[model samples]
Target: MYEHLEYYGVSKKVIEAMNKIDRKLFVPPEYQDSAYVDTPLPIGYGQTISAPHMVGLMCEYLELREGNKVLEVGTGSGYNAAVMSLLVGPTGKIYTVEVVKPLYDRAKKIIQQLGLENVEVFLSDGKFGLEEFAPYDKITVTCYAKEIPPALIEQLSDGGILLIPVGDEYVQILKRIRKHGTKIAEESLGHVRFVPMV
Candidate 1:
């Protein structure tokens, strides 16, 4: 995993999280052997966990701290949220939403099995954002969006970072948006592909 992290140019903080968390624990039983291969694997319900390296890179972009609150727009297999929960430690919280009920339930159960008390999984439209926990310090969207969702930006706290993949269904451009006062700063993180944010 560290080797994959180096290939993605991820930060040391991300490397630590990657090293500490077991990717195999997040995938379905059949794919457990390939979990650390740095590639995405199907988790049923048409969703796939993002490549491990990509997850690391996205998390790195958030610049997470010990007590920060994070909103994860697509839970998939709950891998990202679980790794993030470790980064945020015991004080911080991770709210992850998955539109598919089965996927949400699976992820929720996996998180519980891991005893990640700080991570919460919800079954609902991720585009709406988790408003009950507004003003997240960081937001990470695991799926692709044609455009940045207004609700996500509105829920971001001042100086918050949002990492999302925006483009057509086939491919996307990873972007990092930083909220400043009433303005936003966007930076492209390069080309990629992901499942459409439904």
Candidate 2:
């Protein structure tokens, strides 16, 4: 799996996390057979797990540190949060939200089954951001939103980074937004397709 992710520029730490966090654990039982493949598997609620390459690229871009607190907007299947949790280690915390109640419940159970206590799942509208757990060191959104949420910006700590897909439901630009004091800088990572954010 590490070798496969090299083409996408994943770091050694991220690759190790990917290897250690069995995709099978995060995937739905019905799709367990496709877990290790270099493909996206469907989780219910019409959301698909992000492709491995995309996952690799995002982690590489984030440059996560140990104990970093990450806020993920869409916790579909908990795969992305699980992968990130591994790299950030037991000391790190991931507060992820899923708008769909069922997905949120399933993801929470899956993470617990994997013995990850650092991850927390919330069933709420992700667009509003999780202000209760403010000052996130990093923030990421799995689904595509028309624009970056101002509330998300408000939740990020100084010098924090947010990676989100921006544009229409079907076609969007992957952007990396960084915060420096009161100013925020945005970079267009590329174009990609993803599920729409509720």
Which segments of model 1 are wrong by more than 4 Å? none
* Per-residue lDDT of model 1, residues 1-198, tens digit only: 576577667877778887887888778899988988878899887889888888888888889999899999999988899989989999999999999988888889889988999999998898999999999999999999999999999999999999999999777999999999999999998999898888
- Against the reference, the lDDT scores of all candidates come to 0.90, 0.88
* TM-scores for every predicted model: 0.95, 0.95
Candidate 2 lDDT by residue in tens digits, 1-198: 656788677777788888887778777789888888887888877998987778888888887889999999999989889988887788999999998888888899988888888889899899999999999999999989998889999999999999999999667999999999999899998998888997
| Model 1: worst 10 consecutive residues (lDDT sum) | 1-10
Task: Give the C-alpha miss distance for residue 160 in model 2, angstroms.
Answer: 0.2
Give the 10-residue window scoring lowest on summed lDDT in candidate 2: 1-10
Give the Cα-based TM-score of candidate 2 against the true structure: 0.95
